[model samples]
Target: MQTKINKVELRNLEFDDYKELKNSMVESYPEMVGSYWREHHIEKLLSIFPEGQLVILVDGKVVGSALSLIVNENLVDKNHNYSDITGKYTFSTHNPKGDVLYGIDIFIHPNYRGLRLGRRLYDARKELCEQLNLKAIVFAGRIPNYGQHAATLTPKVYIEKVKRKELHDSVLSFQLSNDFHVIRVMKNYLEGDTDSKEFAVLLEWNNIYYDESPKLINLEKSVIRLGLVQWQMRQLNNLEALFEQCEFFVDVVSGYGSDFALFPELFAAPLMADYNHLSEADAIRELAKHSEPIRKRFQELAISYNINIITGSMPYLEKGTLYNVGFLCKRDGTSEMYSKIHVTPNEVQHWGMTGGSKIRTFDTDCGKIGIMICYDVEFPELSRLMADEGMNILFVPFLTDTQNAYTRVKHCAQARAIENECYVAIAGCVGNLPKVNNMDIQYAQSAVFTPSDFAFPSNGIKAEATTNTEMTLIVDVDLDLLKELHEHGSVRILKDRRKDLYEIKKINT
Candidate 1:
């Protein structure tokens, strides 16, 4: 005897399933009218990233489908319309090595709406993101029910109410429950979508495991602005005094809408006043104790100010050994730690500071970046390794007791910009810290340097601070210029490297 059993399965979309997929899309979006994918459309998507295209079957019948593509993400503007994102139905925007998994379409059969099929499709996308190590799952989702309230409420207010749960939207509410947030409301996003009033919301679901993944967003930004702080060495009464000063600069930089804010090395060293009577090494060890507290505070400030911060170099103690460390406190409430790879002879002799073992370039919303300390910037090999990692900007925070020491860092950093074909921003301390041993006076001339090319300033200096003054220098840089220089400039140093003869590599990860 033969028996019938129920079975449901989810799998990658295939070319033969296009007809069934089209029927399901129509049933899910009856009012969509003329907006539906054809056979070639499904063919192109599967050809590009088959893992991103999925379909669900109920007892051998296709009941739902989801189509996606990988995009550079830097080209995904919030105000972009549907045609702009989809490449006018040709899917020409698909990039094989892109960082974002873009969900171009998702729909379920009308009869299968209550089976949680939509959620299943979404979970699959998240899994794909984790497997591929992409930054996020981004898409423009329609507000289908908004057409009903279009006469009374604006799209922005409607979205706000949906978030607050005062109003319910079928598509948006489901997405929010699936951990997606609306970046902004867009106009004329789709054609012939009367139910949505031609509006959509730019939604994003960040992959939490992105940091562990290889940095894939090398060309993430086009226009990026940076803020550099020329800090003044001073004596502080307590830790709170240092906190107040740190918050002030963060506030000023964020107000200028700068994406990143840099503070000089040892900006928190003002707390050394309490340990003035101790030996220099012991005083630094005592300063290391405050590193944790200040780290937590900088993380808070980074979140509150909506700016990425390089919390200048601080003394860190591990296994009773002292190391100079700095953190990249991101506005997303995450942080990355890096240390000075090359410790200075003066530092080793006076403070017993040990060199750090690991180094890495960072991934940011604007672009890829690298961090180096005072003495580390004097070495060309370190920055070259970072350039190989696709670093677009290098931030150096230094502490110099004399003009000669400051000059060494500045010249080497500028040369790094020219040779690596990237931007380098260097900052250091100024003024005097009287009564503190080995910390009496400081010298600095904080500046932002760019690649030497026709696209940048003739002198390669984008912006500079007044010598030895406590102030902020804000400058804008176009990363696209770096791309052009790499491909078409008069002298393409990065692409023209003599790799066949000489190469640089890190011995261990």
Candidate 2:
């Protein structure tokens, strides 16, 4: 019944024992910083920070400590900060926003754990930033190599086991859990890793005012990769395994260099799966609940990967009717939603889904891309509209029925790619999905295709997943080729179209 006691005070690491701080981390993790990298980190910090700037504190004499610095020095050269010319302007000093605080080290001692000491450290940093009038705070963490969680569930069982013992969670989780928003996941930062594979999180304390429509600067030009967090429909019964598999598919696709990503229609279907047996009106109401989380997660993924993501269709509730819609999200948090304009007759009459009114295009770091949902893609005119606007890539997220039917759809996709002279990506649900009629139907052959050239032309099929299989099909599309074909050619696919002749023939028949 006596009062609990604890001693906590903030102090600078300069006047304190550095070995004690270093030992705290090393003891918990022998190689918290590997032998070769430990010296490099210490040297780097010393070179940049002044003696008193590296703040550390003794929480009851060795409970926790942190190392931080204010990055007020001019960046080495705007261009050197990025891999491309555009970045020179994007990260330039022209930004009125001021300096940033960067945390170099944060570790809690084993003896005094579970006292929310880490949060206190973060609070101290936040207060320091506010007091100093800093514009932002940023830090780097380990790349969550959460491979094991995804291992037993994916096709890479053997490869996954080899990395089972690697530690990857501590730093990244601390940053994210403490309200730090991740800005980018860097490469080759961690020793022994060939690529820049570190997670960079930022906590912006000032209002950022920038115009010219900010785009992902593509700071690191490695093949663009995508990340798809599983789309879960909250109401479905026993879909945990399916969603887990779906997430594994996303990981595989990301690993394959597909810079942009999209999920199948109604990724929130699982959340609304329980309503599969409900009345159409009731189901629509239940489905609306899934939009916010889906948008937020997709936004996070886009920001994390520095890529574009098309959120597969979800039911957007507005003015009382559900609109089957897809959202095109960019790296900086701006997105445009495309509604399914050409809803199937069944969808309109039976399910009461409304058709969208317009066609839209998304301009990305990669290039301009368009979307046409399931039945919407069947309308040649719908795709033609995007072509007329000079879209280079077309994405189709469908929930189709049979493999044979899907083959026809695939052929349509190929024809669309050839005719529009653009890349066509078709993503579909592979396994059984709960239907409105109380039956589950398995979808077929989800694939990505491009116009073929003389060597493989018919733009070769990039990748495809089998009917009734749960997997992601990813490919690096060369948009430049699509641009070339559209510019000059023996065959001008869109330009050569015989629309008038087709109408004449139809009338004659």
Best-matching candidate per lDDT = 1
Candidate 2 residues 1-509, lDDT tens each? 11454556665554345556566666544444442214444544445443313333454455466666655425421212212211222222212243666555566766555667777887777766655566556655543343334434331332233234333444554555555654543433434432223222222333122122344764323233333332322235544543454445445555565667778776556555667668766776677766766677667666765557787888788888778887887867787888998877767665688888777677776656789887777777777777777687788887766767677677888888776777788777654445544224646566777777652344467666655665555565555455446534556677667777762111121
The 0-to-1 C-alpha lDDT of every candidate, in the order given, reads: 0.89, 0.58
TM-score of 2: 0.50
**Per-model TM-score on C-alpha atoms:** 0.59, 0.50
Candidate 1 global TM-score? 0.59
User: Could you give candidate 1's per-residue lDDT for residues 369-475 as a string of tens digits?
Assistant: 99999899989999999999999999999999899989899999999999999999998999998878888899999999998888999999998999999999998
lDDT of candidate 2 at residue 393, scale 0 to 100: 75
